[model samples]
Target: MCAEPGHYKPLDAPVGPEPVAMVPVVQLYARDVPGLAFPAGTDLLQILWCPLVHEDDQYAANPRLLWRSTELTAAGTAAGEPPRPHTVEEDYLPRPCTVSPTAAVEYPNGDLPEELADLLDERFDDLKEKQGYCYFEVATTQQSKVGGYPGWTQPPDWPHCAGCGTRMEHLLSVTATEPGMGRWLPLDDRDPRQGISAAPSWQAEADPAALDTFGHDMCLGDLGGMYFFVCRACPGTPYTHRYDC
Candidate 1:
C-alpha cells in the first residue's frame, strides 16, 4: 500500500552523521517587519534552523534565512522527504512551535555611552521608582517576536557580498526568545507587582555569578544574538551570518 500524500515516514534506522533538521519557526513578510528595508522583489522571509548545533559551534544551533519572492514561489511544491542526519544533540532539538510576528520598537544598548546611561538613569529615577520600571527596561522592551535582534547595538555594517559587491541587507535575527527583555512582556502577561521587587528571586535562581539573563541562557553561554544578511543583488547567492551581544 502507498502512504498518503504529505504523510511523513520515519526511516527504519539511522543513517550518516545525524542530520540536523531545519524547521521553520517563523515566517515574516516585508509588512510584518517594519523599519527594516528589505530589497525590492523580496516580500517573504522564512526563518529556519537546526535545533542542534553543528560540530564546529557548540554554543548555538545554526539558523538560516531565506528571502523569497512569494509571487514566484506561490506554486512551489513542498519536499516529500527532507534530509535527516543520523546523529543529533538531544539537548539542541527544538520542540515544534509557530510564531506570530509583532512589530516592536527597540533601542541600541551600546548606543548610549556610560555617561549618557547614568544621566538618563538619574533623570528617570523618579519615574522609574513610581512606575517600578527602570529607564533601561523601558527603553529596551520589544513586543513578542521570535528571531529578531534587539537593537541593543548599532545595526551591523554588513559587508559587501563576495559574489557581487552589493551591500547586504539584514535578513533575519535568530533569537532564543520572542522578546528577550522582561519589560517587553505582553500586557496580558505582565505582573504589576514583579519589576524591581522580583529581582531578588530572579537573582537567587540565576546561574551563580554567570551571565544569566532571560532568553540569553537558552542559546550560547552569553546573552547575545545572531544576525543574518543576504545579498539581494545576487538573489541566488549564499547569505552571511554575524553575532553580537
Candidate 2:
C-alpha cells in the first residue's frame, strides 16, 4: 500500500508530503469507561492518527480525536473498510486485539505531592516488608489505561486547555510498553526470579511470548507514552495531549 490512491480527496495540508488516509488507532464507547465523561449526546470516542512521525508535533504520531453518537450511525449507512495509508511507519502500527478493561489502583510515577511523597516513602518501606513487593514495582501500572495517573517515564508535562486556560484533565495514556516482567508480570507466566540463582534469569526460558514481543509493539520514541487530555468545562469538550518518554 505504498502507492498513491486511486481516487482524489480534498486536503487541508499545505505544500508538504502527499496526503494519505489516517488509520484507526482506537475506538471507545461510554460503556467502556463509565466514570469518564463524554460530550453531550455522544457515546463514542474514536481516535485515528497518521502513522508517521511529525517533528513539529512533538516528534510523535499526529493523532486526531472524534466524538460520535452510536445511535446516529444507522446500520446500513455504516461505511465499509477504511482506506489504508499509501505510506506508513510500520513501527507505529498496532496489532488488533480485544480490549478487556480491568479495574486497578496504581501509585503515581511523577505527580506525588511533596508532603504526600514524604508519607509515601515511609509507607513504601513498610509495605515492601509486609507484602514482599515494592509498591512502585508491583502497584504502579505503566501500561495503557483509562482514568488514572499516567505512568510517565520522564517528568510530567500536563497540558492546559487552550480555550479556557485551565489545566486539562488526563483522559488516558497510550503506552508503547505494557506490563511484562518483574512484580507486575502476569501470574500466568512463570516468575523470572523463581528459577535457580543464575545470571540472565529473565531470559532463562519461560513464556516466549512475553519476551518475544511487546504490548501493541508501537515505536513510541524510546518507550514513551501519549497522554490525552480534555477540558470538560468547555463546550465540545476541547482536548489536548502530552507525550513523553
Candidate 3:
C-alpha cells in the first residue's frame, strides 16, 4: 500500500503475502529507439507488471516483456528494488515517471485499411471542411507510444504470433491518455501563449494547478490502453497484450 514515494529511502522486504512483485513498466534503450529489432545480444527494453486486475488482457495490466542485456538479465545480475505488490489495482498504479523519448510523426489511430478506411473517410470529411481540424484529430496520437498505430479504443484486436503465427509488431502504448489536452501537448508542456493550433484548446496548457503533472496517472480501466506486442519472428521475443476501454 505504501510503495515508496517520498523521494527515496525505504527498502527492507519481508511481509506476509507470498507472491506478487512486478512493478516498473518501461525501460527501453537500444540507444533510445531508432528502428528497434533488438534480439541479437539485446540492448534492453524491459516492462513489468502485476499491479493487478488481470482477468487476462481484456481486464488489463499483466505486462512483462524483457529483451535485456544492457546488463542485468542473466538471472537479473544483482537485482534489487522491485517487489511491491502486497495489494494493488489502485487503478493499476503507475507514477514513477521519467522516460522522455519524443520523436513524433504518427498516423492511423483507427487501424485503417478498408481501402484506407473509405478513402480516409473522404479525406477526413474534406479535412473537417477546410481545416477546422480532424485528420484523425491532428494526425493520430493517443499517448505513450513507441512504434505506432495502437491507441485504438476497440475494434482492432491485433494480437497473433503464438510462436510464428505472425502479425504482432506494435510494441508499446501504456496509455490512460498522456498528452494533457489538445494537439498532443508538449511544446515544453505548451502555452507559450498557445498558438500553434490545428484547432487546439482542450485546455491544460500548463499550470492549472499542474494538470496532475500530465500523464501516467493510471486510472486504466474505464480509460484503458495497454497494447504491447512483439514476436519478431519469435525465439525469445514472444510477447502479446491488448487492452482497450
What are the per-residue Cα lDDT tens digits for candidate 3 across 92-196?
Answer: 778777755556678775776678767668878887899676676656577777787887777788989987786988978888777564346565665555554
Give the per-residue lDDT digits (tens) of candidate 2, residues 141-243. Answer: 7767778887777877888889989988988888876544322334334446555343222223445565445346675776788889899998888887778
Q: For residues 1-245, what per-residue lDDT tens digits would candidate 1 score against the true structure?
A: 11112212123232234344565545677776675665667888776656444433224455667778888878785768755433434333334444434345655454456787777776678866786756555554332243343433334455578897877765565544333333344332334445535542212122222213223234322344556767756757568766544
Q: What lDDT does the true structure give each of the candidates?
A: 0.49, 0.67, 0.69
Q: Is candidate 1 or candidate 3 better by TM-score?
A: 1
- Model 2, residue 178: what's the lDDT? 54
Displacement of the residue 240 alpha carbon in candidate 1, Å: 3.7
| Candidate numbers, best lDDT first, in rank order | 3, 2, 1
Measured by TM-score, the strongest candidate is 2
Model 2: residues with Cα > 4 Å off, grouped in runs: 1-16, 74-79, 179-207, 210-215
lDDT accuracy of residue 225 in candidate 3: 80
Worst 10 residues of 2 by lDDT: 1-10
Cα error of candidate 2 at position 235, Å: 0.6
